[model samples]
Target: MNKQPSHASEFLWSTPDAFEETKIAAPGTNLELETGAAAGLYGAAEVGNNVQSVWDIASSPEMGAGEDIVVGQKFSIYRCDALLGQGGMGKVYLAYHTELARPCALKITSPGKLTRGDDLKVRTAEEARSAAALIHPNIVTVHALGEARGRQYIEMELVAGGSLKHLLRREGPLPTLQALRWMSAIASGMDYAHRQGILHRDIKPENILICGRGVPKLADFGLAHRIGRGEYIPRGFVCGTLPYLAPEVIQTGDHSTATDVYALGVSLYYLLTGRLPFYADSLEDFTQQILTAPCPEVRELRPEIPLNVAGLVSRLMAREASNRPSSGTEAWHLLNSVLGQLRDVQSILDEALGYDPTVSWIRCGEKYCVRVQRPDGRQQRVFIESSEHRSDEQLLLIYSVCCPAESSFYETALRMNAEFSHGGLAIREVDGAPHFVMVDTYPRGTVDSEELRKSVHEIAEHADQVEKWLTGEDRN
Candidate 1:
């Protein structure tokens, strides 16, 4: 009897997400089951994300040596040409469209990035092909994937904001609203893939790109695969960033939409607090923590975290398979519910009955900016910025209240004390008038787009609160 070949003989398996093609399952591996009755062939892919399937695995696969790329080469796109950058996935040349006069990003993978031997080459091709099939606003569109001069390359949209890693490292965690805004766009992109029956196994900060316009584009579908089909990932390998992997991914190699949600939740936790839910004091502790430890409570780090927001992400971090949100859609809803009621810090302070800080008071502009130690002996500040734009939600998590630094990103939703800066904090009047002014501009992120937006919003919101408090007292 002739054995049927698994649909494993194709490169560029198209389903969803931008980078789903990198993970390929070995189709002809052996499996010993049930007391060694009969060895079976297993095609369990270690790269869990639905990837491109390619047939015809030759003994020797094609590869591009890095030295092969020409300094200025062009690729064809929709009625145009574009240049590629000389970086990862081969030299990415910058290209421009002549007819449309549009610029595009083109990349060619060098053979060096694919050193895992014969089967891995086939898998890489599948990844390129799969990524080629994905097209979304939040996804860098793969214009095409093909080989030139024994080198395989892909053409994609050139987003301006650069990588999320660059942004986060530069500025730190985003304002709650900004992070949510980016997450929503990312979810929409993931939703596009799920609609097409694909799961992004490698959902980490690095793979998510931020466009210059602050739009989030989910890229790097190099490890994606179909729902099943031996899962098309590398066998016995969890191919993704260590911090974002779901519990199931490490245990049984089972992946689905829930896996993506788990990763997103982890990303959000890192985003809001600028800290991981589980930090290992050591390597052993790190692995063990992933296996059995629960994520830290958001409130424990920053008291300002909205209760609904914390609980929402907490549900996604559930260890049990059945407990987490079924899909990114559900996660999106939960996120919105938590973020819907945006309020200024003064209101929150008023509701909390206000706080009195004992420290040095320095005048920032006209308002007083007070610096004080938190209840946990950590230093933090409570100041306000007035903004009609963010009258709803006006606070930021500069850092953990448990570990506040002399300067942090966690600007309070409260008003800044403008009387003095003697080290501790207190709200005092200036010229017999209540006015909270924020005058600190610490560069948090590597670059400052998100940070700038956050600061401007905080400053405006702080000013608004001072005006409100003054008006309310006048009426009384």
Candidate 2:
């Protein structure tokens, strides 16, 4: 008798709000089970998110220092120009489409048992292709799915800014408003995925990418489930990050929309506290804790977090899955309500900057300009706008002066940029003339009066310095 390979070799894999009244499943009555396991098997490796699979592959002898795929390698219609990074499931490359002349992120994986045969491979590819059918701004667009020399590949929109996991690691605990905005965005995307009959069995920070403009895009649908597909996994097997898994999933191997909600709650806790809800040294200990222990309160770790936001997290992480929000749609609305109850954007900005309303500041769309008079009787113009390409979603302040577009000015601008760390000077063409500008950016929502004042002063001071340089003044 021949033994069949298990699909074990495969794949990998936010939000807040509100005191809004909504229906939730009654504790005992909400134990419905959905088939299929993801994030793969309930072993000790399940502690993290989809990355656990990467760890497993890395430790395996098969993942030895494989031959490096150099730049300009061809894969069907796409050419691999650079290796972006590697994950548990496969290696990601920066590839270019020869036909379309566009760049894309190409994820290559063996998918183990999922690719055991021609029929299974074709079916799995079709299932993954279904992900491409999903169209939403908050979700990463899956362009195409194909196979090259038996290796499965997915072509997707390349997000340049990196992942939410990277952001949390770099900046401890996000500002309440920014975190709420991301949470709402993720919830909206998740709701859309659920409505399309897809369950994101694995929902964690690592799967949420922050785009160039600071908008969140949910990625990694390798563990996604198509509803009513009659997929099944043995009872002991499980998928999903253990820390974020709901009690029903652990006890019965059920991966449903509620489980995703539970993961969202765990992610919210992480977003506001920069820590997991539960921590343990062993799998058994972690399992017991997740199955019976209550999630720690977010306010205890970060008291500045709004009460409604914290409360929503606790409810979403409720041990009984039914007690959590029934679906992402409900969670989305709840988040909106919580956001509405918070401070208005204009008030927050004004309060943080200690602006004098009598100064007659000018507002145009998202850009705000203010005129300042220097102590030396010089007038300076300060223009602030939300960055068009923001990796951190901050507001930028610029001070500029018209200058001749000459080699000397370009050299000075480059030198200035290299010398400064806070902000840089640049020359821009306006109406065929050049303007030398000084610009600085600060995180929005959380920047206060002292910081804003300092930034304004620095911009004005730098603009003057640039003007002096252009005039050949010896002022250093």
Candidate 3:
């Protein structure tokens, strides 16, 4: 046998395959378990062609319950119709309720492994109890427990979308309304738990879930615990998401609500910029960045961020808890303000970018020519004409000018997005007339095609208000 080693220096342990493997322009460790074409462009969480919608599942004692199982394998629960993801301590599967058929995340843990580590005991037990105790819309529910064939595990809600890590990797940073909508949900849940005397000591983005664009749920409470009561909880050993842990955790060896705030700040920064504020080669380097580095400014990254939003982000990441909002209600109000501004931006983008024509009109003149300019000073040209101009009967003409003739007019005229309402475009030769053709989604920035349409439509309908509005009004 040939004993020569091949790349023996390669580390046995590695980051998430999906994310770490994919190269990105940002700074951070890859939590992405997989990469798709969408990740290459928009990012991971939003990569899938289809979006997932979830049915509301109730919270009950059954949620906390689960059946046990051995390590080194996955257990499928037919009732839940969900596959639990694998984990280090054990594996967790998604299961549905027997009677309700509600979705749930069922975790399978081996008793043999649990008995082996005293260190894992607190967080492990707390995962079940604290998650069960703190009930909220944003938190994943632990439904029930069961055992079969020498295996044991607990059942929880099946949050269809995977972790936020997957979401961010698949979908780029979410739009503002969606981002804040989710943050509000998470903060509210954490606030509820805080009031209930619990703290998610291990709050991190990996523990967060983006069920869809707006749906977010918290997970992995194995480190959750009753705040004040955990005083005697095995001193010396530290636990929690490293990047998010507060400075106090490093210096004083004490954990507090302020620490949670710090983590929240980190999460907010992540959603806004799609980049971590601080990135390092190792955990120690990460700690250094968190402890010493000044929080990066959001406005500098996304210059379009509103004044209030920039201010709010700055305040949340103030490196001082005293600067943060007093209560969850206050945080919600601040978040609401930011979300409002973000909603306006999205509304503008949707309105400015979408087009739907209520009526059809024909252009039968050589004067109506399409001209487009590219970023590189390149120009494209296209001309449209109909045999006879008509008002009521609809006729559409699309021109795809090749080569130097690649202007914006043809691009805009050709586009028809399926996701939103679009002007119904059908290509049919009208008894010896030219074809009515349409184009679709563009590769990057909007071409002058849209602007050119406004100019031409305006010139065509100068006299009649109806024509002007019909041509320029729906600009979408």
TM-scores of all candidate predictions against the true structure: 0.55, 0.63, 0.55
The TM-score of predicted model 2 comes to 0.63
- In order, the Cα lDDT scores of the candidates are 0.50, 0.62, 0.47
Model 3, span 322-402: residue lDDT tens: 777655555655665555434331232234233524222223343224443323333333334322322212122333222
Ranking by lDDT: 2, 1, 3
Highest lDDT: give the candidate number.
2
Off by over 4 Å in 2: 1-68, 110-115, 348-476
Ranking by TM-score: 2, 1, 3
lDDT tens digits, residues 1-476, model 1?
11212222322222233222222223321110110000000111211222222211211143334455443444333322322222223334455645566766555555444443556556656666666666778766776665555545555666654556546667887777667667766776777777667777666665677765667788766556666556443444344444566777656557789988888887777777776677644333544577798678878887887777678668877777578878877766555545545443333333322333333334455233335433333333444333223312322322111111112212442324443231222233445653233343331111134443344334433433433344332111
User: How do the residues 13-43 of candidate 2 rate in per-residue lDDT, one tens digit apiece?
Assistant: 1011110000111111111111111211122
Once superposed on the true structure, which residue ranges of model 3 sit more than 4 Å away at CA?
Answer: 1-83, 96-103, 117-126, 145-152, 231-236, 340-476
